[model samples]
Target: MKKYIAIVGSNSKKSTNRQLLEYMQHRYVNDVEIEIVEVAGLPIFKKTRDMAIPEQSKAMATKIDGADGVIIATPEYDHSIPAILSSALAWLSYGIHPLLDKPVLITGASFGSLGASRAQAQLRQILDSPEIKARVMPSSEFLLSHSLQAFNTDGLLIDAEQTKWLDSLVKDFAEFIDISAQLNHTHQEDDTRMADFSWDEGTTDKEVSK
Candidate 1:
């Protein structure tokens, strides 16, 4: 079965970052299924007590685990990613790190001139940690500054050039995932062969050295 890909946005309601995610989804012509995991309903993460995690949080974790790659769309607030997004990250970290070793692409949009660049940097740091271990996209694509003017009321991207750029980013990300999977499979096969060879060599060396 083709693995699923997830697009996560910090905001639940109509958000420019969500619109950017939608634009990326439009680029998919392949068989892989893409699902959007909204982080709106999850409660703020707390480390002191065993905070009863909401069902939505658990569902998000399961979806992330099942996904082959994740696209994170977040908006900037006070020069960093929204608190809700951070909380979701915390939740994911505590249990089974769904994001560990996962390929993740992150982008953001805002009304300011910086185009949510600060938030993107902060997110990159978070995702780069050992716990997350995500392969981040290098090029900063899908950063729609003055976002209110870039997208329509129906959440469609209004700028044709921006849409094209985002499409290219998504296509590249998909190809990257495919190549990574192939490399991993090859490594596993090599490991299996090496194990078998090691067993046979050990038996032969013991008899010869005797």
Candidate 2:
């Protein structure tokens, strides 16, 4: 089966972060299927809420669980990711915990000089929890700035230099995903062998006693 990837961002409309994600999707072509997770309809997370989560939140969690890797892009608000992203993260921290040990690549774009540095930094901290073993790319290599003019009307990256850099980033992430999948496969094999060995040992001991 083809590995699935999920891309998420804070905006619901024509957002620069969304544009960057679309650009990345295009680069992958048929190698992998990329699904964009919509966070717009998620209700603000509240622990004391009497109502169940919105359907959108459930859908987002399903997508994250099914994806081989997740990519997050966002705009900086008050030197951090928007509350919308935070709320989504909090909501996904419930049962199943799909984000735990998941491969994640984070990037962002903005009109400010710091690019989405502050927001990315905050997100890195959030993902640093013991439950989440994320492979966050280095800060200098992942942040994209001055996004207002960086993309074309069709959401394609037009700058040759920037495109090259973005391509490199995506390639690196693809390699990381490949390695992670291999490790998971190996771990599963080891687990299966261990289970079989235990069963065999039990059978041999029973035969010896008989």
Candidate 3:
């Protein structure tokens, strides 16, 4: 089964972003394994000195690296992605580049009219950086504006139009993951083939150990 990790990009217990991710987890758990993760356990990122990563951050990186794709649901904080989300990304960008070539989907819920569009846009730009190289789902932005009033008594999204839109985004994301994985696999195979002969001469012991 294809597994996807959903990240709640907030530290607040009352975060609506976490609520939105929980709804998604409940809705899609049966179809695909969905794990909602948070970054509260991780220490703030420091680039100056600490080379050794924390245990919690390592575990988080492993989960993200093993997943077929990732979904980040964040609440807009000052028209940008939350600070916690940025800290988590900084950790992931440290060693093995866990996000490299992985499929990612960015979404959010907000009380304002624009939803979290600005935040998601900033997130997409960061994810597309040459260092990260993540393949973000580009079909449409799933911004749940006025999100507090967007749900019904049954805990389901009340807007039929937005519901359909989200469903389409999920489907497209799945397809994108499949295709991206195949291409990455092909590239890795080619790299392995080319690295097999005369590849030892240019490598340091540390590189060879990996």
lDDT score of model 3? 0.79
The whole-model C-alpha lDDT of candidate 2 against the native structure comes to: 0.69
Q: After superposition, how far is residue 11 of candidate 3 from its true place, in Å?
A: 0.9
TM-scores, in order shown?
Answer: 0.77, 0.77, 0.84
- Candidate 3, superposed: residue stretches over 4 Å from native: 48-50, 185-210
Q: Least accurate stretch of 10 residues (summed lDDT) in model 2?
A: 193-202
Tell me how far candidate 1 lies from the true structure as C-alpha RMSD in angstroms: 11.4
Q: Tens-digit lDDT track for model 1 on 64-167? A: 77888888887889999998999888777654456665777777889887788888989999987654556676775457789878877776778888778777
Put the candidates in TM-score order, highest first.
3, 2, 1
State the weakest 10-residue window (summed lDDT) of model 3.
190-199
* Candidate 2 residue spans exceeding 4 A from truth: 1-4, 49-51, 131-133, 137-141, 182-210
Error of 1 at 21 (Å): 2.1
RMSD of 2: 11.2
What C-alpha lDDT values do all the predictions have? 0.70, 0.69, 0.79
